[model samples]
Target: MSLRARAATTLVLVAAVLGLGLAIAVHHDPAAGADNATLRWFLDHRTPWATHLATALSTVFAPMWVAIAAVVVSVGLIRRDQILDRGMRVLGTVAIAGALAEVFKLAINRLRPPTIDQIGSPEAAASFPSGHVTGTAALLLAAALTVTASRAARTTAITTASLLSAAVAVSRLYLGAHWLTDVVASIAVAVAAVIAAPVVVDAVLAALRPHLPLRLRSMVDVGGRTSVEAAR
Candidate 1:
């Protein structure tokens, strides 16, 4: 994609992300149900085992100070497999972007639902955007990018990613850790990040392309999967 095209794509995505972020923030009605019955199904299976797993997976929303380790570990592992390069890009963007969502939350200092009223108050702290949703979204995107081992694998990847991300969002509400807006914003942030990553990666990859040996550059290019997407 041309630089102008890339810039336009990024602008569109950033605008959408920021727009969705604002929408979720302003629409923070405590009484309203943003709950999706589908996602709450996971909580039904919420055994101690599930909670343990959920707790661990949920840390993608960890404070920036703590997520560094996971990011490092994740990148290190993915780097060995050249095919996994996309995953590293996805996770790295997710880590940085997810942290930003948290920072927004902390700055907004939005109150959790329960504190405002039994039904909850729109009493927001800086919590307009949710980090959990953001992190989960990034992770979901990474899975979508990587887990195409087969038709089954692809199906599993999309379903699991959606469920996990949605479930995590729901958990935040159930735990009263965040307002509904926080969860919604997190999704918006994640989608924004997803839309942002490819365009940036393509540019960086293209620039680094010439310096790398021809053999390596060919491998790096990944057969033009992103060229079309980036242009759009």
Candidate 2:
């Protein structure tokens, strides 16, 4: 692998190790007093307008909605940039991150915060990782990675993504839907997915090229070349 790919692999491995440790820690102490304390603090400190904003952010940034937005964004990238690989990276990152959050939720099966309003919150049953934040983070990170045209644009994109992700994560806590640990774990997992997306999506496209229709094979061929370059 190239130095960039190797660096990304190292980061992914590190995230996996830390995530495993967190899962073990959370399993032993689901309440995670400090985490719950932070969640409660956010709830306690919220103003009416702040609460409304938090609720809106949490609802709007739900995993399903974010996934839908990702699809739209990916289509736009493909159509405008004429780069299938870039679009696939964006979609794949969000999908992979969302899947990781779900798997962790199932494996941990950790209960949501006691103060959480079960009604209208579909993912309130299990909450070791915040699915909304995971999807949001992945979508924004993928955008930052693939959509920028210059160094200044890249910086702006990264800044916007970081701020939006932080807001979404805090919204989950403020709404009493998740503990601090849940959002933190979701961000970590999302980071791993974003870092891996370029290589992973390209590799998958390359593998699928032969199976695609003749007209579509050429589109997949572009991604295959990217896969080879990424692996160099």
Candidate 3:
């Protein structure tokens, strides 16, 4: 199957898993018990250094930092390669993933764990989907997808991004700010966003082709051909 098809299949499977988990969490409250247990375990094992490190990692996904990162990375990519379309695709993935996470948050409206139950200050927002994980996953996945580098470099980038995303997700759980399923669902959403980004970018470029100036149109045509070739 094609790459996009694989991605779509992965997304469907992850969504199903998340859906089943959410159903259990909502209807039976098993997830809450599990979440509590996990938090207890973390608390039992916690040290000052570990807590500090996790908190630091978690900050990378804060909304302000994420926005700044998106701008910096997108602009850097465009400046380095002059691939405006590709840069936009990266930015679009971050935006779409973040928006989708928020929509899910509002829809689920699951409350965060109580402050007395957690190591850190209480979070007041819905916690079914961890925004930290979602944002970090989206940013990392976008970076991995859009990076133009050697095969080894690309592999390394993807691996590092995945690791970093997982670390951030774990940090949320460690802090008791989110349930396990919250991070899981956010990951599913991030994967879907990353997979759909290029397809969406291509469609947008196609629609704009007719309106682009002749010089710019030719450049796009060449870039499109090169992208297709690279995929092979």
Candidate 4:
């Protein structure tokens, strides 16, 4: 099968799994574990650890990563290097996916676990999807696409990004700030961003590449010599 077909299949599988999980959660008593012994034990013994971990994940999911991406693109533009600028095209997909995430969050409005012991509860939001996870997924996807040079590198970046994103979501649960569903929602947001960005970026860059200056036109042959013409 073609690469596109394979990717589509994978996405379908993921959606199916997510759907099954949601069905089960919806049918079950998600809130029955408020007084679970394991959670209480952790709250009693590892409060500090949970707090620290959550805080750290929060930082990773901050807007700072987006700002950094803009900077990277800008720098690439200034240098007349086209690669980074090309990645900007993908950023739009990220934005749309993020917006979708918020919409879903609002619609689901699932409550956070009461006994999770976090800073705030999702009073009117779905706990199944996580906004932080979404943001992290978006940022990581954009970054990974921007630097897609190797299979190992892409795998590593995705892995790292996933771990960090998951950590943030887990932290929310550990801190009692959110439920597992909330974290999952956030991850859905992020995953959608990544999944959509590449296709969008490809179309955009293809349309724009023709307008780039000669100096940065060749990413594959970036080292090709070019003579600058003197200003008239």
Off by over 4 Å in 3: 1-7, 10-14, 21-25, 29-33, 213-232
| Per-model TM-score versus the true fold | 0.62, 0.81, 0.85, 0.65
Q: Could you tell me which residue pairs clash in candidate 1?
A: 108-125, 108-126, 109-125, 109-126, 110-124, 110-125, 110-126, 110-127, 111-124, 111-125
lDDT of 1 by residue, 1-232 (tens): 5667756765675565555555445765443454334234443545566555555545545546235644764565454443334544666667656766766665455445545321123434465576667776676665475554578988887778778778877656554456565676677667656666666655677778778754334242355654222222
Error of 3 at 167 (Å): 1.0
The segments of candidate 4 whose C-alpha lies over 4 angstroms from its true place after superposition are 1-3, 6-45, 63-80, 83-86, 120-126, 148-152, 207-232
Q: CA lDDT of each candidate? A: 0.57, 0.76, 0.76, 0.56
Error of 2 at 196 (Å): 0.9
In candidate 4, clashing pairs total 22
Clashes of each: 10, 0, 0, 22
Give the Cα-based TM-score of candidate 4 against the true structure.
0.65
Candidate 3 residue-wise lDDT, 108-212, digit = tens: 788787777677677988886888888889988898876555788888999999999999999998888888878878888888888777677667877887887
Quantify how close model 3 is to the true structure by its C-alpha RMSD in Å. 3.4
**Candidate 1, which ten residues in sequence have the lowest lDDT sum?**
116-125
Give one digit per residue, the lDDT tens place, for model 4 in 90-194: 456457556766566555455655633655433434555655566666666556555445799888877887776667666655666555545554565565556
Q: In angstroms, give how far residue 5 of model 3 lies from its true place.
A: 1.0
Q: In model 1, state the lDDT of residue 190.
A: 72
